[model samples]
Target: MIHIRFSDNNYGGEIDLSGTPGDLRSIRQSIIKLLQAQDVQVCIPANEVKPAPYDSCLNSLVIRKSDCSVKVMVAGSSLKIEGTPEKLKVFADWFNFGDSTESGYHNHFDYYEGNEWVDPASVSLIISCKYRGTK
Candidate 1:
């Protein structure tokens, strides 16, 4: 099960997401709903027509806010993502929906280590927002 824990000053909850390797419609909906409830903007940066090998899908994301933070935990490892509200949302979306039927974007393959894929059951995420003023 994909478990996502979301926390902010006004809201805090957890969601268990259901889906499979190639499809993640439900996961996308749940995450987008959570971001919308937080009033965080969702943005996708333009991708290069010819991306280089090893290029990051989110490499062009710009940081507009210093207080907002999002983190993901896979297995026992923790990853912290820093950016504006939109970038953070983009990262979150990609983390859950990348390469799946729900996403129009290409595979970030973030869940893969080298040539192997990580088990979805061991994937969990924590999204924490500390936005001040209008995001």
Candidate 2:
């Protein structure tokens, strides 16, 4: 669950990405642009505030009938990717966010590792930002 509350009182919202691989992938691709931009803003009307359907079943299915190579999740302002070290390296290689020098805004990717349970390693790449919503 990612709860986004802006510094300004006018902006706030939440998105539950608990077990939705598809949503996670979609969101990852969408926000990849943030690595270059100085700031990106979003707006959601008060009338439109509602919950999306949960993906518990879908997530369970994907995790169950597959090799434990890679799993991705979105937590707040960070992206959590879990898998083997080799697999994680491969993912980092595949994350071609382009040359940062061209954009002038140097981007940084911070990784947090965990050992909640052995075998496939886990890492969380955190990108911190206050939500900016239009009033």
Candidate 3:
């Protein structure tokens, strides 16, 4: 079984797939496509302090997923995908982020690969689909 583990402070979950290698490949491709199409400057929300004052902002990230879809954030090529199972998947760990001549705010990831950053507030949608091979 190929398992994708997801976690956050409020929740932790996993999705297991028994499909073939092509399924995994398509999923990875979908994630890449979606992220590439999103804005690169995703703003991390600052925690609200009514009666308290904190100096640092929170490293908050929310992940959304369905049975065949995934919505997540990645900084440059530095994403959180692991290929431990060998039979499952593998993703690169690093890519450029802040080498642009624009706002100099730094980018976390590329949407498809070798592409510019998109608006930070953009949310990506990836539909998990099965690719059928014609005989």
Clash totals for all candidate models: 0, 0, 12
Deviation (Å) of 133 in candidate 1:
47
Determine the C-alpha RMSD for candidate 1 after optimal superposition of all C-alphas.
17.1
Instruction: Give Cα-based local distance difference scores for all models.
Output: 0.31, 0.29, 0.26
Name model 1 segments beyond 4 Å from true. Answer: 1-18, 21-23, 38-66, 74-84, 95-135
Q: What TM-score would you give candidate 2 relative to the actual structure?
A: 0.24
| Shift of residue 67 alpha carbon in model 3, Å | 22
TM-scores for all candidates: the values are: 0.28, 0.24, 0.23
Candidate 3 vs. true structure, TM-score: 0.23
> Tens digits of per-residue lDDT for model 2 on 9-106?
22122222221233233334433433234433221111221332321111111111123465544433333344444344344333233322222222
Clashing pairs in 2: none
lDDT comparing candidate 3 with the true structure? 0.26
Model 1 per-residue lDDT at 45: 30
Over 1-135, each residue of candidate 3 has an lDDT whose tens digit, in order, gives 112212222222221111124433444444444345543222222222221121222232222222221223333321222112211111211211222222212123213433222222222312222122310
Which order, best to worst by TM-score?
A: 1, 2, 3
Q: Could you give candidate 1's per-residue lDDT for residues 1-135 as a string of tens digits?
A: 222222222222122222242234333454456456654332223222222221211212211222433332221111223334454456545545433233123343233344222223222332222111211
